[model samples]
Each structure stands twice: as C-alpha cells, then as structure tokens.
Target: MAPQDRLTATFTRADRVAPTPLRSIPQLRVDGLSVSYGPHEVVTNVSFELGRGESLALIGESGSGKSTIARAVLRLLPSGGHATGRVAFDGQEVLGISERGFRPLRGRAIGFVPQDPANSLNPVRTIGAQAQEAAALLDEPDKAIRKQLILETFAQVGLDTPLRVYDSYPHQLSGGMLQRVLIGLAILPRPALLVADEPTSALDVTIQKRILDLLTRLQHDLKISLLLITHDLAIAAERADSLVVLKDGVIQEAGRTASVFSSPASAYAKKLRADVPALNPDRYAALRDTGFRSLKTGQAPKIEVSAVTKTFTVDGKALTAVDDLSFSVPAGTTHALVGESGSGKTTTVRLLLGLEGPDTGSISVAGEQITGRSPEALRTVWRHLQLVYQNPFTSLDPTWTIERLVREPLDRFKIGTRKERDERVREALANVGLGEHLLSRKPGALSGGQRQRVAIARSLVLKPDVIVLDEPTSALDVSVQAGIVEVLLSLQATLGLTYVFVSHDLALVRQLAHTVSVMHRGRIVEHGTVADIFDNPQQPYTRSLLASIPSGGNDVAHMRTRAFG
Candidate 1:
C-alpha cells in the first residue's frame, strides 16, 4: 500500500470520532507541575490536560523538561527529584497516592515506552517470556491466551513471522524490531494513557514510519491518550494532534499541530520550523549531472571496490554481512552507500579502512589497489584517508584538550613537529569554525554540534585525500546538520578531497550525495545519480526509501508509499 493508501487505512481505525470517553473523569491532569532534581528544578509550573484519546506532543531539543514531565506524571522521577504537582487520573489525585497505590495505576492506567528500547528490554529474556511477563501483571493468563495476544500484537506492528520473533531473544532482532516488541508490551495491557519518548529515533525512516502508523492506529482504536515526547518537528506535525514546544525548561509555544506548523506563535517555534531541511531541486539537479557526466568518461574512480565480501561468526552462527559486492567512488565527489542497519555499509567501510580483513575483495583508492595488505603495507596509505564516526563524544577523549586531540593525528602520522603541530591544530580549529579558546576545552565542555566539529578538525588535521564519513551528522539537529554539510562541502572544495559517505537519512542524502547506492540485505539494489535515485528510482526498495521521506505537500501521488512493504 502507498502512503496515500496507508493514510486512508488510518481513517478506517476511527470515523474522526470524539476523543475517548474519560472512564472516571479527566484522563490525566497536571497542575503546577514542578519537578526538582536534587536542588535543581527541571520542570517548572507545567500544566496540561489529556482528555480521553487526545494526543499532546512535547517537542524540544535535548535537555528540555519534556522527559521530566513524563516521569513526574508517572511518579518515576530519579532520586532527589520531588514532584510538586497535582496529578489527577481517573478522578483520583495521583500525586497524593502512596507508592503501593501507584503501582496498580502504572501499567493498568499508564504505559511507558522509553526512548532506548535497549534499556527497557531484558537482554537475557526471550521476546515471548518478556511479553508474557508483562501481560501476566495485568491479568491471570493462560499460556495460549498470552501467546495468541503476543503474536497478534507483533503482527499488528508489521513484524513478519510473529511466532519466530516471540521465540527469539532480543539480540536476535534488529533495533527497529526490538522497539516494536517493546511497543507491543507497553500497549498489551490496554492502558488508558501511553507515554512515548523518542520512540522512532533509533529506527530507519521506513521502520520509523511503520512504528508511527502503528502507534497512531492503536491510539485511535484503543481510545488511549498519548503524550508524545520528541525533537522531530516532522514527526510532531504528522502524528500529534496538539503540540507543546519547550526550551530550557520553559514552554515556548503550545497549540494544535496544524495551527502551530502553519504559523508558529513564538520565535522559538518559528526557528525550529525553519531549521528543518527540505529538498532543493536545483542543487539536486546539479549534483545529478555531475555524477553521470563524470562517470561516462574514463575519470579516476573516487573509490573502487571489486568483488568485496564479508562474513562474521556471532555466537557460533556464521553470518554473511556482504556478498561479493562492488562499487566505485569518483574523485572530488560524494559516493554514498546507503542501507538499513546490518546491511553492510559499515562493513564496507571497515574493509576499506583495513579495520577488518575481507575474505575476498580488492579496494582501490583513487587508482591504487590496497586490499588484503599487511598492516605495514597500509600504514602509508592510511595517511591519505580519515574516518568521521557517528558519535563525536566517544571518538574524542574526555581528558584530552582539543589542541592535543587534533595535533595527535599529525604527530602520529609524523606530518609535523611539536611547534608545527601546534600551528596546524590552531589552523584546523579555525577551518572547522572553532576558535583558539575552544582548543583548550575538553569534549564534555562543548555542545554536541561543537564536539562533532572538533572531530572533523581532528580528521582534517592530517589533510587526508579521502574521508570516510559514517553517519557523521545523523545525531545532530537539522540546523546544525546543515552547517556541518556546508562545512564538509567547503572543505572538500578547498582540499580537493573525495568522500565515501555512508548514511540512512534520505533527505540529507539528497542534499549531499553526487551519486547514490541503495543497499538491501548487503546487496546494492539500485545505483545511480541522486536525481535518478530519488526522482526516478528503478528498484522497488529505492522507491520505498524515497517514499518514506516526510513530504508535507497534500499531493496524494507523492505520499503513496506505505510505511513498510
């Protein structure tokens, strides 16, 4: 089914019915909700109401008080965080209830789907055991009844082979699948209110859409009120009925999603909307022509992979990650290898970087082949290649100053002496738009976007000819991501470097890549220019990916792709 069909399918869940009836009165009400963590107050003077099946999204960047408000509503705040709010659910004053009294109301009246499914699920337990345990808490269960419900819930979220999934452990599934299992357990009890915190952040665009559609459908059918907490404006616009914009623990804006998105009342709301990245047809056209034109001639491949393959043995099970796949990267351009998690994009990068040895393959940089080479043989080649990882914080040492971090690369590669290294570090910081003062600061002292800049500066300090960027900007804000992409393009032009950019963000991919390769199950399903890939994709999977991208236009033809096929 297309997204248009799915949207129509969503209508079948309900007939635009009134919000769910409040069984007792006021489904949930928070009055003067002020929650303090130790002596520091996180949520202050917050008040909201969820009438029956209504959905109210809490939108903000990281460090906002959205999560705190959810925790206070469930009385699950961390130690020293005392909530001074009058919380009423089912006509009972929940704030006055004791711990014992609150226990029954938890899963029965309110269900919580946390941000990280890894943190929520028991790693040692099978999906069936966990789901059954969760269900048992709500009712005296027969094994058949519990298993049937579990299978039904799994299928409802579009997971294939529900029985196989139930029998498998959490580690056996992908991140998206694990999240769906967690969602199933949360809603199995049929709680009146569901609190979802960054539910789809970890999943791919396609899986994210499926999960969103499932949650929305469940909310409608079950008449369950929803408190959606996330930083994505597109997601808020699509799923939420009402929106509450928060900044620095303060309410920036609050209103219906349609009205707020159409014309935000506050400056913060306007800025957030402005920050979102949209497609640029002209730039995309330019990138498309460049890739095909460059490819037709006998120009040097930016990167060349011939007969590349990979395999790994996990827990005694042999897994083939990549299977004899090959591709090329043109000089002075971006060649993106895109796929979902476990689709071998990262494996390909690892093989190219010599982090892992391939069973059989050859990798060519510019024109020089360097595969299955000894450590000593590739050491010299690594000088011209650098890698930018997903998380900048983990990549950068907390104890090392930015100057030391950047200069260490130069020192290791023996490009410069102490004085020259110092000079190079200063210049590199400036190149990445960081100042001299920031060079002395540690990673913890900087923000997420700044930390990523430092990581880029470190990679650039060596003046590499090719940079392998692995989801470098995926974890950043849309506005910050735009800045990072601008910096990368500017640096690529100035340094005349090629990039093997690996990512799953289709919108960002359209904005960045000169050539695009869509990977599925460790195989390249579609290979073409960005325009060819997005505007006229040949492969069904590529079409699905293009369709998954959020399009607010009311064109039924445009939104025809369903969440998952």
Candidate 2:
C-alpha cells in the first residue's frame, strides 16, 4: 500500500477502537530514575510513563543510556550498577527489589527481548532445550503440552519450519531466523511488558521489517505494553506511540512520536531526525549535486561485470550464487548493488574482487580482466581494488595499534620507506578525519564509529582506485552513520574515488549511489540511474523494497530528487 493508503487504513473506524482497557495506574512509571555504575552515573533523572498496551521508544546513539534505562526498569543491570528511583509496575513498587522478589515478574509479567540473538542464545544447546527451559515460566506442568505450545508460538512468530528450528542449534540457523526464535521465546508466556533492545539491528531490510511488524502485531493482539530501544529515529517514529530521545543520560526530547518527528525541539533531536536517511535522504546532495554529468563519455567504466556466473558445489549440489549478473560502474562515481541476504550481492562482490572466480563469465577492473587470473596476477588487481567489510568490530585487529593497522597495507605492499610510510599513515588518517593522537590506540579503546573510520583509513592507505563497501554503516549508530556518509562523500569528491556500495538499505542508497542495480534471488530485477531507480522503479521487487522504507511522513528527499536526481 502507499503511504497515504497506510494512513487511511490505520485511521479506519475499525482500527480506531482501543484494544485493551488501560489500567488506572500506568503500566510502568519511572520517577527520577538514576542508574549508577560504581562511581559514574550512566542514566540520571530518567522519567517516563508507559500506559497499558501502549508502545514507547527510548532512542539515542551509543552510550546514551537508552539500554541502561531499560535495564534499570527490568532489574537486569550488570554488576556494580545501582538505581535510585521509584519504579511502579502494576501498582507495586519494583525499585531495588531482591532478585528473588523480582523473579516472578521478570519473564512471567515483563518479558525481555535482548539484542544480538547470537550472544543471547546458548551455543551448545538445541533450540528446543533452551525454549523448553524458558517455557517453564508458563507454569504448564505437562512437558508435552509445553513442547506443543512452543511449536505453536514458533509458527505464530513466522518461523516456517518450527520443528526444524526446534531441533537445530543456534549456529545452524541464520541471524533472522534466530531472532524470530528469540521473539517467540519472549512472547511464549504473553507477558504484559515486552522490552526489545535493538532486536533487528543486524538483520537486512526485509527481515527487519518483518520482525518489527511481527512485534507490532504481537503487541496489539496480546495487549502488551512495549518498550522499544533503538537508535533509528525513523523506526521509532513508525513503530512507537510515544518517544523519549536521550543523550548522555539526559532526556533531550520526549513526546508523541509524530510530534517529535514533525517538530523536534532539541538540537540533538533535530540532528537525529535529519540524519535518518529515510527522513533526510539528501544527506550527501551537496557533495554529489552535479551528479554524473561530469563523467566524460567514451571512457570505459572503472569496474565491469559481463554476464558473470558463480556457482559453488555444496554437499555435491551445485548452487548458483551469481546468475548472469552484469553492471558497469563509471569512474569517480558510486554504483550500489542493493539486495537482501543470499541475493548474490556478496557473491558478485567476491567475483569482482577476484576473491572467487566466475564459473562462466568475465569480470574486469580498469579494463583488465579479473576472471581466470592467477593468485600472483590477482594481487596486482587487488592493489588497485580494496574491500571494506560490514562490521568494523571484527574486521580490524583489536590488539594492533590504529597506526599499525592502517600502515599494514602499505607495509604488505612495500610501497614506501620508513619515513614515507609514517607520513602516508598520517595522510590516510587525515583523509578519514582521524588524528595522530589515535595512532597508538587499540580498537577496544575507540568507539564503534572510530573503529569504522580506522577501517576506512586502512583501506585507503593503499590508494586503491576502487573500494567495495560491504554495508559499511549498517552497524553504526544513526548519527555516526551520517558522519561516515559525510566522510565517504568527502573522500569521493576530493579523490575521485570509485565505489561499489553493497547494501540492502535503499534509503542510504538514495544518498550514496549514482547508479544502482536491484538484485533479488541472484538476479538484477531492475537497473538504472539512482533517479530512475528511486523515483520510478519498474519492477515489483524494486517497488516493494522502496515501499518498505520508513518515510516518517517526510518527503524532503523525494522533493529534492525531482530537482537534481
């Protein structure tokens, strides 16, 4: 449905009726909540009210205490954390209660959905064993009945193969499937309060939408009070009834989600609203305002894939990963390959980077063929081509100093002298907006954004002509993501860098790419300039991806695209 149609459907008479009788006392009330971890106070004077069956979002960047506040409410704070406040839940004081006293209400009444399902679920145990343990909260004495109920809940949460999921361990499933399992476990007992902490941050766009929609449906159908914790302002605007914007343990803005989106009072809130790619997709407009008009005609593209096909043999079965894929990226411009997971985005990138050889087609970089190249020959191509991974936390070596990490590429290539390499290291850091002060610092000593900047600097140290960004900003906070976007644009504008941005985020693609190829099931469904792709996508799959973008009722980007795109 169109945005207007969704609004109409939402405001229909049948949908206007309230689902549950709200309690006289608010479902939860936190009065002057201050959480201290040892000597430092992380969350201070936080206050919010969640009415029965209503959804509230605590939103902010990292270290903003959004999760801290949620943890305080649920009494799940880590060691040495203390809270000073009045927390009233169901007309009873829950502040500073004993672990024994809070046990009854923890999962039975107030369920929790933690972020990072990989870290949350037990690694060694099967899903059924872990789920059965969680189902104990239902107080169902019969084991077989509990097993049946778990399967039913699993299917309810949209796990297509509930039995298969039950029998499998965590590693056997994908990230999205594991997340659905976690949601199923959280909702098994039908708790009144559901606290989901960044549950869909790691998933791709379609899966994220499905998980969020499932949560909304579960909230309404069960009449459960919800507390959504996230950094994405657009998601909060679309999902929550009310929102509380936090910064450094302080409430920057608090009000209805629509009011907050329409009229954000605080500067931080306004910046966040503008940083959301869905709400403000023209983030890098000024840098790329001229578009691809300057690219001279008759010049070959920087990267080209001509009818590339890559198939891997798994369990004696040939799996075609990239199917007749072809796209050309002009020099000094970005060409995004947008698709969901397992849609051949990574496989195509691997083919381009010479990480994997194509089965039956040719790939080229800078007019040189990539397929059928030896490892020794591919090194020459790799020197002019580099890759930026999705997660910086793992891509960068934690033990290596930042300077060493960036300088390693130069060292491996043996491009410069001792003094020259030092100067080049500083130059790369300066290019990515880093300073010499962070040279000696380790990855653990830096923030997520800083780590990513370091990763970019390392990639740039080799002076590659082409860089393949693998969902570069998907893991960072919204503001941090905007900063990264700015850095990337600045680099592209200043250095005439060519980029193959691989991602599923269409909104970010609007801000980043000059041309795009929409891939689905290992095939490009639509291919065009960014303007044609975003303004008038022809394929149904492309349209569906565009529709899934959370507009937050802001059309500034679309309006700008008509003028410049």
Candidate 3:
C-alpha cells in the first residue's frame, strides 16, 4: 500500500486503541542511564519513562546532559562517548543491540527531530528529493507512492503549498516552515515515538505555538509517544505529562508536570520556574509601574520617527519593508517593535539606528536629523546611537579579546586617552557584571549569556544615548535570557539609557517594553503601552499573537488528574 494510505490505516488503528491507561508498559524508559565521554562522566543515574501516546520532558541548562541522554537513546553518541544502563522501547532493551541489529529500529520504529533544521536537511537538494530519499529507507519502495506520501505529510504539517515546498530547496523556506518539513519527514513512516530536541527554541513565539500545537496533535491523533528535550521551563511545564529536571549530569527532580511546578522540591527546579517569563508573568512588568526610570516626558523624546517608510529592491521589484511607521520613545524608556519575521521590525530598527536612510519621512535621535546624512555625518550619529545585534556568537569577533571587543567603540570615537579609555572599558565590563579576569579571554571562551553581556558592554562603552537591541536574548536559553534581562534593566535604571528593542516574543516584550508597536505586513497594526496592548488589544493580528502564547501543559495536567482519579 502507498505510505499515505498506510498512514491513514495507522490513524484508524490509533483511534481504536488510544490513550493507554496509567501503569501500562511505557513506550520508552530509561533506568540508571549514565553516559561518559573520555572518562568524563556527563549523564549519571538518569531515569525516566514515557507512557504510550504520552510526552515526557527533560529540562535543564546547557551541559546538563539532556541531549547526551537523548543521543544515547538513539545510539548516536559521538566519539569516545559511552553509555551504560537501560534504554527500553516497547518493553525491549535497545542498548544491548549491535549496530547492525539497531539499524532497523531507526526510522522504522523510532524518529528523531533535532533542534536545527538548517543542519538537518540537505541544503543542495530539493525538498522532494530529500523526502523521497528518506522514504526509501523504510518499507515504501515505489517512487510515485513515496511522492504521494511526501506531499500528503507536507500538507498535513500545515504547509499551504506542498508541491511548492516539495520543489523548493531548504533555503527557500523560512525557519518555521523548514521545521514543519523536518517534523513531517520524521513522521512520514509512522514511527511509534518522536524525540524532539529544542524543536522551537529559535522560532518566533507565534510559530513556536504552531509547531508545538502540531506536536500535541500528532501525539493525540496519531498516538505517538514523545520525548521532548528543551531548556524552556514554560514549554516543559505546559506540554509534558511528566518532567525530569536535570543538572550537572544528574536528575534533580522528576514528577508530574503540574505537581513539580506547584511545589518544586529541588532548588534548581524552583529557580528554573522563577526564571521562566511565562510562569512569572509579572516580574519585570512591575518596574514600569514603580516609577523606575520614569519617562522624561517634558524633555525631547530620545527617538523621534515621523512617518518613516523604508523600501528595498527584491528581485528587481520595490518591496516596502517599513511603511508609514511613526513612533516616539520617551527618553530613558524602552519602546519595542514586535512582529513576525518579515513584519518590518528589523527594517524599522535599521532606519532608527541610521544604518539605512528612510525612503520617506524623517528620523531624529536626540533632536538631530538623521535622514539623508552622509556616512561621515552619520559617524557622529553612531556615537550617540549604537546597536546590540541578535546573536552575540557572530557579532563579537572570535579573534578579539573581550577587553578589545568592548574597547573598540571607545577607540573608534577617540573618547579618551589610553588610561581613560582603559578605565572606561573596565567600567563597561563592570556594568554588565563581567569581571576583569575575563578581559584577556576571547568570545569563544565565554558562555552564550556572558557573550551577550560582553556584547551589551560594547554598546555601552561609548555611552550612547540610544541603544537599538535587536532580539538580544532570543539566542540564549530561558535562564540565561533572564540573567541578560536583569543586567539590561539594572543598566537602564542606573544610566537612564533609552532603548529601541525588537523581538518576536510578546512574552518577553511584555516584561521589558514600556510602549510597543505591533507590526504586520510592513505596517504598525497596533501601538500602545504594554498593558493596553496586552490587556485590550485592538487588532485581530495583535490578539492572535497574544493568544499564541504556550499554555498547553494543561493537557498533561489533565491526564495526571484523570489517571489519579
């Protein structure tokens, strides 16, 4: 039979035998699993189980061995990596099997969806070719049947144009679409268990919601067991039936998702809960209400954007990137521009920072007209207006030391003599809570959060009046993001720095932004205070974005209640 029709038969079977009761044989189980690499133990005594058609989350910080355990489960450990203990799928031990014997278990009985789709898919091959190649590994051998299955899976994964997506290369699709394609490829063979590792961490909140909802539906309708590995506590809390909190290669806590969050036993688990923005929704919002760096209303606004329109030539056609955008950021406050990937947030920030002149309208920072300025003139504007890029890993020169990286702006502007510039560099480092010892180290030596902090310190070195932060924390994990946010808040309160923040995460924006503009299709759909925008949004697009926030842990919570009853 064709794979598409085979998938339909599998669904019919699932409908007849779904939601295996509590105490049944688990679909996946790990008992006392310990993994070591070159005599260095990374995962120790980790134990967890996923019930049939259920999801279990493994959550922790980086180097916590979450992925290590996952790799061990799939027998994909890297060089010198050794795993001991039990990994059972469908009550059969998988670890004892040899490589030749294990080959059949993969792609037929088990499927894996890794974190990065860009690396997972072949860049040079058409999506259809790649899907067909993957399909050939299973029982389906007919080319036409494989093509039909691939198209059916693509459409089912919410791709509106399956044929177009099938014909296009991986680069032609957006990150979210690529992720959907990857998921579809994994499930095309009707695997019994799906392992998703950091599946939506890099996506926009709206897209993340869709991907997660799709996963939930796959679990419910297809009755596939799921093992979710993520550092995001909010997603783990809402999506998993059970949670295993890992730290330093050991299981810190494990229990029903709702039970653990309600009264976490481990300090690590509690700290993770405290740091997640969705769980503690109001932590940073109080700062705006407490008169912290209250806006200097009487003073000239820090950023004045008047009817700005930015256009670009894409494929020999005029593309309006930002259309008639107008917003004022009061001095010493944060104004966030939020939208989907193509919604003009980046273009608006580019125009505001004078990186690009507007096609129409004017932009002024601190009352200085920035529109239509020569590059030499904009150099002066750049001194008072700096930018913090999205990914610090790429932004900071890997070859430069942290001190030199932070000191570049000051050196460029010739702000001070050798001694004074050195002193300013120290001050900037101190501002972000980085010690002097890290000065000699390059960005490669630092963690993601530390690198971002160094990035922030660099922007602050010039003591710019306005800073454009473009998705500064999106690249970091949740706790690291929280740490970076704390530093930014402290810096803003102490220095009264004006900020233009850009992000696709409404949850993060709610905590950080004073005023927010919801951008869509290169236009401002709604603009208002964070409170007004969230509580009483006026636009349908704005409401949809707000509604996309992940709160699906309730499904597993409900299952817990049902099982206990």
Candidate 4:
C-alpha cells in the first residue's frame, strides 16, 4: 500500500472507536507528592487528580521534574531516588508498596509510553517478541491466543505490514513506526491509565498528529485516563483536558488547558505561551521585513543546487535519496527545507556539503562548484561552509573541553595562532551569549540550550558564508528554541550570513525562513515564500502538512469565554 493509503487506513481504524462514558470516581490521585534523588529534592508538594477517561498534561521545561513525577507514580524511579507521597490508583495506595505488590498493577492496571522509542525498546529483540512480552503481563495465558491478539492490536494501531514489522528489529524502523509499535504494545493490555511522556517530540508534525489521534481514540474506547507529559503548550491545549504547569519540581499552576493557555496564572506559563512561535503572529515579521537586501544588489546566490540527484543501495535495492532536486539560497537570507523523515532533506544537505557525490547535477557554494571537488580542493570550500547538527549532546566530543571543541575547526583550517584562536573562540561564544566560565567545561556539563549554543559557536568560528542547520532546535524546548532562533536572526542581520535550515517543524520554519521548500519522497512538492507556503499552500501535501498542525484556536476561544464570563 502507498503512504497515503496507509495513513487513511490508520485514520479509519482510529475513527471507528467511539468515546466511552467517563466514570465519576478518580482513577488516579496523587497528594503531597515529593520525590528526591539522594540529597536533591526534585519534586516538592506536587498534587493532581486524574479522573477516569480524563486527560491531564504536565507541562514544563527540562529539569522541571515533570518526568520525575511520572516515574514516581509508577514507582520506577532510579535506585537513589526516593518518593514521599500518597499515590492512589482506583482507591489503592501505590507508593511504599513492594515490587511484588506493584507488579500485578503495573502493566495490568497502568500503561507507559516513554519519550524516545529508540531508548525504550530493546534493539536486539524483534518487535513481535517485545510486544508478546507486554501481552503476557496482562495475564493472557494461552500462547496462540496471545499471538493472535498481538497481531490484531498491531493492525488496529495501523501497522500496514504487521508481519513485517513484527519480524523486524527496532533499528530497522522509522521513529514514527517505532512509536506506533510502542503504542500498540502499551494498549494491548487495555490498561486503565496511559502515561505518555513526550510521546511525539521526535516525530514529524503529521506523524505526531496521527499518534495523538490514535491515543485519543484509545482513551475514548478503553475509557482510560491519560497522563500526558510534554513541553509543548500547543499539544497540551489540543489533546489534554487539564493542564499542570511545573517548574523546579513545583506546581506553578493547575487548571483547564484552554483557561491556562488563554490567561496563564503563572509567569512561567505566560513565558511559555509567548515563546511558542505559532502563537506570536508578529514575532518574525520584523525579521522578514528586513528583506533579502543582498539579492537586490546583483550578488550571486550563496548556495545553489542544480538538478542534484543522489541514490543509495539499501537491502540490495536502489533507493533514490534525492531525485533531481534543485534549490537556491540567496545571500543574507534563510531558506528552509521542510519534509518528513524520508523526504530527502538530509540527503540534499549531504549533497550540498560534499559529504556525498550526486549521481547527476551540480552544487555550488559561493559561486564555486563543489559537486566533484577533491578533498584537498574542497578543503578551501569547507572554510566557507559549515554544518550545525541536530543533537548537540552527541555531536560534541565528551572528552574535549568547550574551548577545544570550538577551536577544532579553526585548528583544522590552520587559520590562526594560539592567541588568535583563543580570541576567536571567545568572540564566537559571546556571539551566542555564552560566558567565559563555560570555556573550560565540557559538553556534558552544559545544559541542552547551552550545548546548542556551543554548537552554533563552533559553526560560526569558521565565519562561514553558509550554515546548514539540520534540525538545530527541534530537540529543544520552545523557549530555548526561541532564544536560538533569535540568536540566529541576530547573527544573520549583523554578519550577513546565509542559512539552509533543514527541519520538520513548520512553526519554527515559518518564523525563521524567508523562503520555504516542502519536500516529499525525494522531490520538491512546493516552493515559495513563507506566507505563500503557510497561508496559501498550493500542493496537496503542503496543505496536509499544514492541517496536521495542532491549532488551539477553539480552545483559546473557549478559555476566553470561560475565564471572562
């Protein structure tokens, strides 16, 4: 079946499940919940109640202790972690219970879906085997029946080729596919409460919508309470009934999702709302209005790809990674390439960066051809082009200090002396708003936002004309992403830099890119200005992508009326 057909089939299954009536009694309740890891108290006096068939979202940035609270409920905290609280599920106390006591209630009564599917599943095990284990936890004694039920659940979750997915390992599937598998496993037991922690953070917008929809359908059909932990306020507004805002292990505010979004009671909540790029209409207008001034001056385009085509062999079959792809980025402007995982966005980047040779077509950087350049010849071109990768944690060397990491580019180019290199590193750090104190610290010691800043600094140290940002802010929180976006805008305006931003985040793309290209299956489906693509998308795929975005307009209006009236 085709991708669209698979998606349609999935939607059909999701829509078939009718909403179950909610029960009156509280399904899960936590009172005076306080969790600590050794001497450090992460969660302090957090309290919330989740009624049957209700959805409650815990929203906060990293280190806010939202996830810690989720783990505390399951009694799945690390060895050093301790919990001081009353956790009741269906009128039964869960905290302070023995492992054996909690065993029966875990997968049988409550289900868990973690953030990263990659980290949750055993890479060595087959998907069917892992799912079968989950089925066993539900006390399904008969082997033949359990296997049949597992496959049925997989089909219900919209796995097109259930047998293929069942036999495949974790590493063989995409993030969206893996997430669906995990969701399928979680719902197989038909638990009363489903805890989804950042379940869609790593997925594309369209895939995220499908997953959320599936979860909603499951909740309605199974009459299960949902405890969703996420950093995205938009998702919370769309999918959750109530919102619990946490900061530094403390509850900042608690209320209906719409009410909180419309008029946040806490400063943190308001800040988060302001940070969401989609909510702020005028945030990027000024930046965009700055316009492509360099384009009018008759300057050549900074980066150009003319009919570039790249193919790779996978499973003894030829896969066209990038098929006759063509796009250009003018100087001092941002051009975004938006697509799903296998849409050839990364392949195009690889082609542009000279990491891989295109089978056909030409790529140029600053008017210099780079498609067939030798390594020695391309060394000069490397100075004018740099890439800031997706994950800062994994990209930076753990053993190296911040100074060494940032200076490695300059050292490789043999651009400066020790003093000059130190000055350059300091200057780069300052540009990204990092202080000298972090110079000696390694990437591990820095926070997510700080490490990303370091990565940007490393890329800027070369003072490249074009910086290819590959999902640079996708893994970050909204506020952190806003900060990074602001930094990039500032850098572009001041230094007159060009950016080729590759991302799945349409919201961020709207705020950052002047021009947009929507790729689907190795081809550019749509290309135009940001307004044209977002406000008036011409292609069906682009329109579908836009529709997939969770719009909280209805919730906002409902909140407004409820709060004021």
Q: Which residue ranges in model 3 land beyond 4 Å of their true spot?
A: 1-3, 6-23, 285-293, 296-298, 551-565
Candidate 2: count of backbone clashes, pairs at least 3 residues apart or interchain: 0
Candidate 3 clashing pairs?
Answer: 238-553
TM-score of 4: 0.93
lDDT of 4 at 254: 96
Score residue 115 of candidate 2 by CA lDDT.
Answer: 95
Candidate 1 structure quality by residue, lDDT tens digits, 200-297: 87778888877877787777767778899988777787777779998878888888777987889899888777666553334434434444455566
Worst 10 residues of 2 by lDDT: 556-565
> What are the per-residue Cα lDDT tens digits for candidate 3 across 514-557?
88999998999999888899999999999999887765347645
Off by over 4 Å in 4: 1-23, 295-299, 555-565
lDDT for residue 173 in candidate 1, whole number 0-100? 89
Ranked candidates, highest TM-score first = 3, 4, 2, 1
- Candidate scoring better on TM-score of 2 and 3: 3
For each candidate in the order shown, give its overall lDDT on alpha carbons. Answer: 0.79, 0.86, 0.86, 0.86
Candidate 3, overall lDDT?
Answer: 0.86
Tens digit of lDDT per residue, candidate 4, span 1-565? Answer: 5433433343342332224542444888999999988899999999999876788999999999989999999889999999998998876788978989998878767889999999999999999889888878645466766776777778888889888898999999999999999988887767778999999999999999889878877777667789999998888887888999999999999998768989998999999888887777458666655545664464568888999889899999999999888888888889999989899999998888899999999999999999889989998998999999999999999999999999999998898898999999999999999999999999999999999999999999999999999999988999899999999998988898999999998888888888899999999989987878999998899998988776666753354234323
Best by TM-score: 3
Model 2, runs deviating above 4 Å = 1-22, 295-299, 554-565
Instruction: Give each model a TM-score.
Output: 0.87, 0.93, 0.95, 0.93
